[model samples]
Target chain A: MKKKKKRLSLMRKRMFAGYLFILPWLVGFLVFYIRSIFQTVQFSFSEMSMDAINGGYTLTPIGWENFRYAFLEHGSFKQTLTSSVMNMLVDVPLITFFSLFMAMILNKKFPGRAIVRAIFFLPVILASGAVVDAIAMGEMMMQGGVSGQMQEMEASASSAIAFDIDYLISMFMNLGLPAKLLDYITSAVGRINDIISMSGVQIVLFIAALQSIPSSLYEVAKIEGATGYETFWKITFPMVMPHIITNVVYTIVDSFEQSEILKLADTTTFDMWNYGLGSVFSLVSTIVTCIILVVVVGFIQKRTFYYN
Target chain B: MSMKKGRIKKAFQDPYQRMLLGNDIKKFALTILQIAIIVGVCYVILSPVIGMVVNSISGDKDAYNPMVFIFPQYPTLERYKLVMLRMDYWPTITKNVLYVLTLTLIQVLVCSMVGYGFARFEFPFKKLLFGLVVVMIVIPTYTIKLPLYVTFRNFDPLSIITAIKGGPINLMGTPWPMYIMSLLGCGVRSGLYIYIFNQFFRGLPKEIEEAAFVDGAGMWYTYFNIMLKNASPAVITVTVFSLVWQFNDSFFSNLFLVSPDIVISKKISTLASVIANEDKILNVTLQELYLHAGIILVLLPIILIYLLLQRYFIEGVERSGIVG
Candidate 1:
């Protein structure tokens, strides 16, 4: 129809406008992304040296030596990479579940709800590299008790609570779980604070998803005489399914990107001037991360129910 | 006999009352559990912060004293004084704050435009372009830092600037790299912000925009006057996130800024290292105290910002489900 043609022209106009709007970012993407990715790959395979002839460095192709060094020569590089990937495998799910659970709890009507929400979000504010490092340092001081003085400080400070963690550990030891499993559990326990801190953004994301769910859905379930538990399963759970995937993806990328081991790679490249080796580490890590993301997304996409 | 008869009468009088009594006990038990969890978690979160504060104020003698647990009897600002003298805290903080604020502002404007583009229109390669945006979000900045560093160091993309300048211009140890990245929507997490905005703009009703179109407003006008006015929540979210992230971003800042007065996160790290290495006169415990003081100094601005904007920050986050 003539009307349909007219609408098509309008769509074309809108598309042009859209392109115009995204022009700056497009320019940036062209300049930065494609070029950098190419150069990164190039740098990974070459010996980079300062060129006095020109201002910038020159790359002489060295083949797969950088990659080989990263894999074969650097002992800790492979170890850290594997361990970090393993950590992400555990951390991503744990963070997603923890955030979702906490979000559900915090979404309920409670006294001091605002304060509780703020408390949960306090981590996002304190998520600075400095603060994280500082907290880690503080923990080290506590655990190591750097001096006799620090030991006194700890004893006086913690004397009131007396949780008797040793007793709990001993009891768990007696339960006959394998030693490796017990070690994992203990380390996980130690990492609970880190998990809690990292989950702040995910928790907020889940909370927002929870809030946007139509109250009418809950009312409909209630009218059918659904209990609180049934409503959660039948309504809340399905509605928030997509956000779960988002949180999982976000958490996975975050863990991999910010892992302590990746930081070591950064220092190696930039600080130690091991550009070739560092690029290999960076490239491999990026590939591993992409693989994990694709796998996770594919799995989650099957379960994600898009209503609209 | 009278007591037994009374009990039987009371039980017979109201089954509803008996149910209410049972409910009260359940509620009480639930409340106890809630309180315990909340208190425990809060303590775990706050303990390090408290430690920093306590150590910052505590005298050297207090660290040795078994009796001084929370506060020092002779609280002193000596550690803070040492940190201030050594770190040049004020100049560094001022520069860091200015840089973060300006960068945040630029990112908010640039990214929202990019977001609006993705959200509002159908274009060729739209899917592919947006996919690239998603890739930008996924790939860590460290991976590309080398190339980015070279790109900025040369100060030319496609050699146009080099052609103009007759040679490459080195821009290391300067703010141009950050400025250029932010202006072009390639700053830290710029892609994420664009995605957030794109999602938000898509969620907005189309009828209002159509009305603006009918009123003869152009796309830019509709976006600036109509869409932006209604997109305050998204703006707030982006701004807060950009601010916090930029404030916390030590890695990139450290890589770029070779100047004396750099961002707080970088400054704190360097100061901690310097103190750890340089303080021979101070005991191990006192050196630790000074480091803690330095940490507190760096955290003060961010903590203040959070306190001031807590309400908007909460609303911004609560409304960020559009991204989800």
Candidate 2:
């Protein structure tokens, strides 16, 4: 009875220590996260303009005016939001699947695997906003450089390549593929390079998950005379389900945040000084992304089998 | 029938030929397919980087030449010189290096503490608090950008300072926003790091901590000396991740580090405009070669760091304890 009481006290002490450690995060959550969320919602419904006299923002209450403008008056706003959603839907699955496939292949013992893995992971380093912006600027300047005549030659050369691409695309179209399907396929083919770059983190995460699965499970399956296909479904697939959820959640957030159309909203708000309208744009996109995340993650969570 | 019999006899005579008839042939085909994909993807990821390098060194005359794509015909340091002069690389890089290192160090220490707290101990509302951390990871920064900006602009927390000063204290145009956020466990990808650390700590055997508890060591002593010493893998993982993220991060820095020349990213961002203005004044024609060279130069440090720390970084990724 005395020992039990001591154990209970020890537990209480440990709990106290836990709160002490997390105190900073708790304070931050209140000060930064929750407060910021409320402010965003409030600012979206208000008119905020900078006062030149004191370099301060003057806010006038305007009920849903920004949101009304975004939904009804702002033509490009709705279009951009829809296109961003569509892009996320398409990009997420492709990225997740491709990363998993690559991770599985790279997990095997093979010649030059280390180099291949490094190549796959290189994008995580280069995907920084600075590098990406620099590359974008460089490409723009390269095309818009002093040699207009040279650009003309390059354009013609690209057009020649385009003709061959069109020919190959037509071959698929000849098989009675839908026009939309053909377009998506052609675009995806063009962006195959981008897909590889974007999958670096996901591939790394999946490879880590794959490596953590005990080999004993596989050995057991083999002893049971399970084929490779069966072992994958019964063992590897189930084992990696939690990682799948993690990857899916990651991919969803990443795609929505970095979508091309959403970047338009960024330029519109910050660059064009339409802070109210921009807030509405961001809030709407964020809400949609959250809805998708809750649905997908909840669904995957139900299926995930936890070992511990 | 006679020809079939002859073929069977030949197959029996040559075991190597016979091996190709069924599963062996399928395995061979699968191996070829796997290699093709690995090589193809590598090429796709590599070509742009290679293109960047090759074009950065090509002379203006060669860069304009239609025939020069992968190879530089007349390699010269002219573009590099122009880029170096335009970017003011040395001072800008040094400043950014200092900022990244300092910020990264703070984040690594603070985030590890938070993660350890969540992972190793139990407390009231622990589940709810950790859920908030997960939400922090999920919610896009844009949703909170305005409020965060406002909060930083005022530079007051919990309204205590506001009550004292009777006005907003502006922290804009200073590094305080980054320092505060990082210290508070709300910096860039802090949630992810905390999550990684939490997973790692959970995976560690409980016996080690139990042993420490029995040895009459205080929690701080155990955590600082024993627990941390045993957690070298997680430390390396978190450090590399924090350093890289902080270095690459421009979103928060762009908002707070409003000084155009304080950070490398900020400088790179304004490079085009700076050059355009230079063109208007200096009468020197600016072209894409300088821009390409500048981009390569910006990426050079990161590339070097990654290559140097490849072993530790890869090990971190492989053994981060983020398993199902």
Candidate 3:
């Protein structure tokens, strides 16, 4: 009983220590982050548009109204969301597989590996707003920012179908299916190009997780006459299951929080001020993301996670 | 003090760390893959940048093909000069460097202390508070811009340098906000940094502290000698992370001090913002110069720091909670 009491006291003391240590972060976060999130939701509900003067909505609240605007008034909401998801569909998997692959490869021993690693991770260093802005400016000069040249390119390409050249592909076009699908796919790809550029950290995380796997398992597998593919299946895949869940959740959360793109388009539509709508959008996205995360993480726990 | 000579020797003898860090066939393939992936990744990341540079440099009057990746057949430095004259690059850059340094240092120290406390001590409300930290991990900092902007709008930059704007006390459009942010360890990636420190410090051997306590040493003494010494890995890691994250964190600085009142250099405008705002940087004739200059200016500090801290940064990343 005395030993039990001592153990209990020690546990209590350790727990208290942990709490005290993390206090500053907690206070700062509540003061800064939480209230802002609350405010953002509030701001979303109110009508806002960027103007020559301070760009914002003249704050007002209209319940479930912004949803209507997003869904009913502008079809672009669904389009952009779909486009974002589609981009993610391509971007996330490509990033994950490639990063994981790179991570695995990097985990190997080789000469000049440090230099290579630095180069690979250099993007994380370069992904600053400064770089982004510089790149954006550079694009403006070459692409003419938002000039009609791009539109002209699309127009010219579309017009290509009108010429004698049309005869060769006329049968394919008349089926009407391929043209529409191709056009839609191109447009969708163009829409979410911005989000695809920001997967540097995801790559790093995949690499780190890959490194955590023990080599003894591989050696054991080698002794067992296991092939590389088999080792990946039986060892690597199971070892990094937690990272998969983490990446999925992180990607979803990031996709939602970076609503800056939408917030821009919102400026033009529904001139009414509504913070509630903005908040609602954030809340809805976050909720959806969280739900997806919980389910996925839960499933992962059951199917893959093993107690040590 | 019980120095782990045995452990140190064993660590030196440890084949795994040496094997991992040292060169071998596995490392060679990884190095190649890294180079390839880096090239691909860099191209994507640099494409828009190359585009921006092209846009800024092109001699075209009404419209330059910014996305033009082909080297500008006519590269010019006129835009660089224009941005310099227009943006007040020297003063602005000085201010930026100073601001980043002040903010990073304070934040590092505070975060280290707080992280140390969390990792080593037994205190109250530990789990709940730690949970709050975890929750803050996902909590976006941008959400607080409005209120904090309001709160700090009246405050002043703290006592730092004489040449800086906003006096020794201006918060509105001053370095003070970023500086204060560091003290709280709440900058761009400070949350993660704190978490890193926590994890690193937690891994520390408790025997050192316990022995210190047995000797009637105070908390500060134990912390400085035992915990801090043992926490070289964490410090190195946190410092590098802080440097890099603070260097690149354009979002918060842009949002906070983005007003016109800010002097050209001390402000948080980075290459990304300059590129984003290329049209306004200088007139068309000097666009090319601005492009190259912007890249140099924005990247120079971080690049230099990165080079200097390369080994340490890698060390930190490795010592960190996760990933190499």
**Candidate 2 segments whose C-alpha is farther than 4 A from its true place:** A1-7, A49-54, A64-69, A143-190, A215-226, B1-27, B81-98, B112-123, B142-176, B196-241, B258-262, B270-286, B313-324
- Would you list the rank order by lDDT, best first? 1, 2, 3
Give TM per candidate.
Answer: 0.80, 0.80, 0.64
Native interface contacts kept by each candidate, as a fraction: 0.38, 0.49, 0.35
Worst 10 residues of 2 chain A by lDDT: A141-150
* Candidate 3 Cα errors over 4 Å, as ranges: A37-91, A107-115, A141-196, A206-249, A259-273, A297-308, B1-95, B105-142, B155-170, B189-242, B258-285, B313-324
- By summed lDDT, the worst window of 10 consecutive residues in model 1 chain B runs over B315-324
Residue B294, model 1: lDDT of 84
Per-residue C-alpha lDDT of model 1 across residues B74-164, encoded as one tens digit per residue: 7999888878878888888888888888999999889999999988888999988987887788776876766677687778667887689
- lDDT of all predictions: 0.76, 0.74, 0.57
Better of 2 and 3 by lDDT: 2
At residue B284, candidate 3 shows an lDDT of: 33
**How high is the DockQ of candidate 1?**
0.37
Ranking by DockQ: 2, 1, 3
**Candidate number with the higher DockQ (2 or 3):** 2
- Residues B108-171, candidate 2, lDDT per residue (tens digit)? 7887788889989988888778878877886667667767887888776667887999877988
Residue runs of model 1 more than 4 Å from their true location after superposition:
A47-58, A65-79, A109-115, A131-190, A214-226, A260-264, A267-274, B1-13, B17-24, B78-95, B154-174, B198-236, B258-262, B270-284, B313-324
What's model 1's lDDT at A145?
29
Provide chain B's TM-score, model 1.
Answer: 0.81
Model 3 per-residue lDDT at A7: 85
